[model samples]
Target: MIEIESVTKSYGDVRVLDDVSLTIPTGGITSLVGANGAGKSTLLSVAARLVPADGGRVRVDGMDVATAPGPVLARRLGVLRQENAMSVRLTVRELVAFGRFPHSGGRLTAEDHRLVDEAMAWFELGPLADRHLDQLSGGQRQRAYVAMVMCQGTDHVLLDEPLNNLDMRHAVQMMRMLRGMADELGRTVVLVVHDVNVASCYSDRIVAMREGRLVAEGPTAELMTPELLRKVFDVEVEVHELAGRRIGVPWS
Candidate 1:
């Protein structure tokens, strides 16, 4: 489990995360949703140690993120942040192979190659394996990055705005794949998603943030209420039961 206790972060005078505390258990898909500047991304960064917290602590499966060794932590947690910029051009296969660096130390063994191949296959990136990132569409590039994370094979995976460039079809496919990572592979998957309906439809739990605080969090059914939506988003939303799935629609 990822245990966050009284976590806080600030930029000069402005507090981004104010005494935030949350626990994400192992082996399920959890979605973080809220308006912009709600600290969803910041919190994930703090948890993954991509950003340092001002106070408090984050622990991953009894390992403290603050003091853990870089290589040791890298092997346990894999994070895919919003901004991925590369100065040099690299093929999709080459980019994905980088995920094995922590395990392989840049010398890919036969097992590392096998894992890379499996990740490419999982994201359906075999067709574009040789293409550079700039050559592929936004959706395709996003999938390639995700495949890289998948190849990392960490027990806990954190992705921020994974559906940003995906079409509806690809968005659904990404959500399905995230769910599969948890259910089929027994990995803990946490993501920051803007689409509440997508989170409701696919995530086991929904954690909502507001003004740098955790305002609401629970199972999908409990988090889909119009009252909670109004509180978190300052807009009304309606929940519908369709095909045994709880979906949220904008209130008319």
Candidate 2:
């Protein structure tokens, strides 16, 4: 479990995350939904120790995120940021191998190589494994990046906008893959998502944030409502139950 105690972050005079506190459960998919500048990325970066919180602390499974050793924390947690700008000219396989550095320390054993290959295969990157990132399409590159993160073999995975730039088919495929990761591999997946309907249909829990604070957090059916949608996104939406799933249709 990831425990956050009064985590706060700021940029000069502007506070991005206000005295926020929340516990992310051990397994299953949890989606973070919020509008632009709602502190979603900031919170994920703080949790992953990519950014320092101005106040409070974050703990992953018992180790303090701020003080934990880099390799130790990397072995237990993997984070995919919103932007991945790689300057080096590296093949997809080489990029995914970087995730094993914590365990392999730049020396990949047979087992490490096997894991990397498995991740590449899991994300359907077998054909693109030798291709460089710049050579692939946006969706293909996204899948390669996701494979890299999965190659970390961490119990906790944090993805900021995993579905960015993906078409409907790819988006649905990614969601299904995440579900399999949680249900089959028992990994805890948390993602910052823009589409509330996707959040409603896939996530086990939905965390709604606004103005740097968490406004609501609960099961999809309970937390997803017309009033909640209006309050969170400031848009009137219709909620429907189709095929035992709660979906939202924003009123345009």
Candidate 3:
């Protein structure tokens, strides 16, 4: 579980996150939705301790994220930031194996090798395992990064725009794969998504942020109403029930 209390961040005079207090419980997928500058990504950064908060505190399952030992936190939480730019050339297998560094300390054991293989297979990267990152398409590269995060074997995973640069089919497949991770592995998954319909369909809970503060949060069913969508995205969207899911369509 991640406990965020009065979290705040600012760039110069512009505040990115303000007094944002949130509790992400264990073992489910939670999606954060809002406008581009709504502080969704900033909040995730603070919660993951990747960005320093000027005030308040964040704790993950009783461990203080800001003050805890680096290794201790790395073993418990895995984060995938939106900007993934690698300078060094590495094969997909090598990139995936990087996740095991926390456990293996740069020397992989047999168990580490097994987990890496499993992660590659799970993300369907077996065919491209030998290919370098530069050789893969954007979607394939994104999958490799995701596979790396999963190979970290952390209980909590925080991702910023996990669906970026994917086609419709791959996007749907990615969401389903995340759902499976939460249900089968009992891992906590928190991601920032722009598509409200996708969040409504795959997420157990939806967290809405706007103007540097969290405005709404609840189960997807309760959070998917037209009223809430308007409040968060500032767009008029019609909510419909289809195939046992609530999807929002923009006003035409």
Candidate 4:
């Protein structure tokens, strides 16, 4: 479980997260949705320990993120940031193997290699394993990054804008894959996303943020109403129930 208490971030005079407190339970998909600059990505970054919060505390499974040892935290938590700078000319397989560094310390064992192979296959990157990062399409590169994150095999996975470059089919596939990981492997998946429909369909819980503060949070069904949409995104969206799932229809 991830526990965030009174988390706040700021850049001089500009505050990005304002006394935000949230609890993400273990073993399910939780999607963070909001407009741009809503602090969704910043919140995820703080939870993942990639960035420090100016105030409050974040703990993963009982370990304080602010003081946990790097390897200890990396072994239990994996984060995929929205901006992946690919200045190095590494192959996809090499990139995935990097996920094992916390465990292997740069010396990969046979088991580590097997796990990397499994992650590549899981993300459908086996065919592109030898390709350079710059040589792949945006969606392919995104999948490569996701595969690396999953290869860490951590109890918690934090993803920011994972569906950014994916096509419709790939986006659906990614969500289903994440669902399977949560249901079958009991991994806690936290994602920052813009698509309300995708969040409604895949997340067990939805967290709504606006203007750097969390406005609402609950089970997806309760959070997917038209009223919340208006409050969070400032748009009226009709929610239709089909086959026990809430489908959000944005007003055009």
Best by lDDT: 4
- Cα TM-score per model: 0.98, 0.98, 0.99, 0.98
Scanning candidate 4 in windows of ten residues, the lowest lDDT window is: 243-252
For candidate 2, give the lDDT of residue 53: 94
Query: 67-155, model 4: which lDDT tens digit per residue?
Result: 99999999999999999987789999999999999999999999999999999999899999999999999989999999999999999
Clashes of 4: 0
Give per-residue CA lDDT, model 2, range 82-180, as digits (tens). 899888988999999998998989999999999999999999999888998999989988988898899999999999999987999999999999999
**Which one is best on TM-score?**
3
Residue 113, candidate 1: C-alpha displacement in angstroms: 0.3
Clash pairs detected, candidate 3: none
Report the C-alpha displacement of residue 31, candidate 2, in angstroms.
0.5
What's the lDDT for all of these models? 0.92, 0.93, 0.93, 0.94
Where model 2 places Cα greater than 4 Å from the true spot, the runs are none
Q: Could you tell me the lDDT of residue 98 within candidate 3?
A: 95
- Candidate 1 on 15-34: residue-level lDDT in tens? 99999999998989999999
Task: Supply every candidate's count of residue pairs whose N, Cα or C atoms clash at under 3 angstroms.
Answer: 0, 0, 0, 0
